[model samples]
Target: MEKFTLESQFQITGIGSASGLVYKENSLFIISDNGSFLYQFDIPYNKLTRIPLVKNAQENIPKKDKYDFESIALKGNKLHIFGSGSTAKREKEITYNLETAATEEKDLSKLYKKIKQTATLSDEDLNIEGAIFFNEKWHLFQRGNGANSKNGIAILNDNFDEKGTIEFILIELPKIKHIETSFTDAILVENKIYFLATAEDTTSTYADGEILGSIIGRIDTQTMKIDFTQKITDINKFEGLTLYNKTQDKMEFFLCEDKDSEVLETTIFKLTLDIKHN
Candidate 1:
């Protein structure tokens, strides 16, 4: 077993940091909910670059409200971005290449329609916000709608197609009565999975609150079951996570926080792990 501690923090100038992926050795590509801008930032050096939003993505979106990008996954050289549309009818998966800057879009609704026309039960109601690749498959987690919403994880294939069907793995909250908690992002380190989540208090609205609550869960790749779960109640809303492989015996976890503060700003924390085997 090992313990984790925060090593470093930095501010990011973007809002609704829905999804983020490591594009290069020390660079990250980030997307936000309020704008169609893609930002690239270099760690340590702290350089920032911005790219334009997709050309016609706004047309397919159904509402004038902001779309929260929930998850991000990488396969080979392509980056896959997913977000909860304003309506269920507008869910989308966008694929882009960092090397050549090529892009493509897949309308999830159309895929669901095709699967439904064939008489199959698709979990179309899932509002996916977190995604990670493990054991040659993709796992997606969604933030449910309303108080009674069920939080679950879905398994997808390499082509981003549903493996068979989405499995609803209900996340039981300890202090909170509602399952309005959103699993926003996840990362795979070695054979374990770590995820980030936020809980909405009863008196707090979606946008305003103490924003205090984060959970890290470990999944056994062999059985696809969560083996260990730990909750950290002091940290604010975390949007993305990445595992950095440094030395053979050293492992570090980076967490991106989504906050509107000026001084603390948007931050990335480096967690140094101290592992001890019994």
Candidate 2:
């Protein structure tokens, strides 16, 4: 069977709960799920810089007040960050322009509610953890970490100025040791969707649980079917994924982990896989 291998891994100190990742211009931009700042790391994981997401904030945002930014995507010089709509406070979408250093925020409460209705998902089952822009549309991955445990993709129209059409495609992910897997983050290259998912032994999106493991999966977007899935690690809930490099035979990715600890340090892993043709 064709599968990916963990060729290398590294640690990025001084960042915690790395839930979102985007790579551009030889730099990695990261967002912690519970932090008050955005982090930028130079290639080779050498230097680190923190950009305040909240102005004039001297400390990390409180858990209840934090936006719970979970997934991110990059388009040109702009970075789109999404909050995991697990609560009313998390119903936010943020756009950051790198060129002008300006940020815009929008309340996505209505959109999330519409997604729940369209997908037939209960209000408790709408935790969005992965996002990517493909074919001029925004694809949002909803984590199956609630009572209903429904994993799916919510497609939204590119024109965000007005409420455009919405669609949902539900998915069933491979399980780990009887525990269901849920989407954490994903990236798109060519026509394939590569995702990182974790198997947390919990039903509520608000609570953390046993870190069963993490998996790397691929889906053929044309068919809307999973191509392959392989466990990447036995521990460490990796919540962020971004392409590092790609060649004809091999593909490399950078993954970041969220241990759900208070240590204030996160690990960045380098993974390699054999590229196969179907």
Candidate 3:
């Protein structure tokens, strides 16, 4: 177990809201929810480069704010970025080439519609936010919409074939100050899983409500075991996370916050995990 702490926090300017995070080479590639540019940053995050994606085509990402990109998963050089399957059910996955910037769009509507029907999820609670690639399959996190407040994970193959699913047993999670959080993001390291549970003040599936901060936890997928959990009260609407440095005594991560256009803009910060928790 590790005692996590927020430290050395900083902000990245210009990217309105960060939705997904991934790393290639020494650059960190972050996706924005509001635009066509993929944000790239160096280790220190002092330098940033905006890489553009397809936006002009109507079939591509919508020009409106309706298309919400939530989380990203990496498989070799092919970066799989998924849209949060909100009420629209127009789920889209864009597989992009890291080196050449080539792109291919995947229509995940049918697959997601099937998942919703199988899970008995209503339109409001059908938002798929967090994602990762492990165990030769892609694991996607589903946020609990409305008062249901039950989160879930979906395991899919490369072609988005539904393999199996696991809904979070709330009693297994930490007794947080805000237990109403939706699973936002996650990362895997050496068989250890760290994830974000964010509590926002919204009442629907497609709106951004007041942020109630977030909690980071380490859990096992097999047994639904939580080794330890930390409630971070600082970062607002935290959406994306990535491992920046891992050491024998410490594991450092870069956390990006998706503050809405109202209060504070989008930003990235550093978080430290002291790998010793009682």
Candidate 4:
């Protein structure tokens, strides 16, 4: 399989670190796990703007680095922002009106309780960092640790409720300088499932992890197999990516990377894949 190339990159100003990105036409919506604001970035112009969370929600935002919004996805008229959930018992998701940005928070307390009691999640290493709407359901990825780590795909209904059992898959990735790459985000185009994974350095789960490298993996849903794998060498920690646009031979992807500091690195990428092999 052919890997993707980083066509160009730009240093995003204003916000420090962003954990998730959602694209709508030419506009990119980004959420910072370290801050309580959502940003709207105009890709072509490199323009940036921020929208604050509800005041009460802002006050309740955790001070820890990882205990914040981890991913963003759009479903019909609602834009959902997911929290990394400090622990299984604390998970939460927020839905915003796509047009007005009006928000409503739903604590995933009951859902997490249901999963944990079923032995689906073995340990605290299970963090829902990446998610995508696909096949009339939500595919959520758990960022598993290295050393025989098994990352799982949670199958949820359109309402963000788990249906049956979680799907298990091993991500094939060679450690870049020995850091275990973990799944960060996912993109689904038809029957193909693409995952955005990253390897970073952090002392604990609550700290800000310094990104070491990243990789993108393609999975074939029909055959339940891994089709291709691509490694990203230059980007730091890309916690999120979106399918901007595509044609027959090439596809455009936009990404946001966490700098482990204040500003993030926003990049535009074009990937070419040989369909014959798949």
Candidate number of the best lDDT: 2
By summed lDDT, the worst window of 10 consecutive residues in model 2 runs over 52-61
C-alpha RMSD between model 2 and the true structure: 1.7
Residue 258 displacement (Å), model 1: 1.9
**RMSD (Cα, Å) of model 1:** 4.8
Better of 1 and 4 by TM-score: 4
Candidate 4 residue-wise lDDT at 100: 81
What residue pairs clash in candidate 2, if any at all?
Answer: none
lDDT of 2 by residue, 1-278 (tens): 55667744657787878888887878889998887577888866589988776666323567778888899899878888888998888888888888998888788889898988888888777899999889889899999989999999999987553367888898899999989899999899987999999999999998899999999889999988999888988987989999989999889898888877657777778888888564
What does the lDDT come to for candidate 4?
0.67
Q: How much is 202 displaced in model 2, in angstroms?
A: 0.3
Off by over 4 Å in 4: 1-3, 44-46, 56-62, 65-67, 88-90, 117-123, 146-148, 162-174, 201-203, 208-210, 263-278
Per-candidate TM vs. native? 0.77, 0.94, 0.86, 0.83
Q: Per-residue lDDT of 1-278 in model 1, one digit per residue for the tens?
A: 34656655566654344345443578777765444556677876888766655774331132345454556677788877776542453367777787898877787765434333333223443456677777676776655433435555666566655435544455543333343455667777667766766765533123335555665556666666666555554556666777765465556667666653323135566665554420
What clash pairs does model 4 have?
A: 16-262, 16-263
Clashes of 2: 0
Best by TM-score: 2
Which regions of candidate 3 are displaced past 4 Å? 8-10, 43-45, 57-65, 162-179, 262-265
Tens-digit per-residue lDDT, 159-240, candidate 4: 6565455444545555667676777888777778877788776534455556777887778888757777777654567777
RMSD of each: 4.8, 1.7, 3.4, 3.4
> Under the 3 Å rule for N, CA and C atoms, how many clashes does model 4 have?
2
Q: TM-score ranking from best to worst?
A: 2, 3, 4, 1
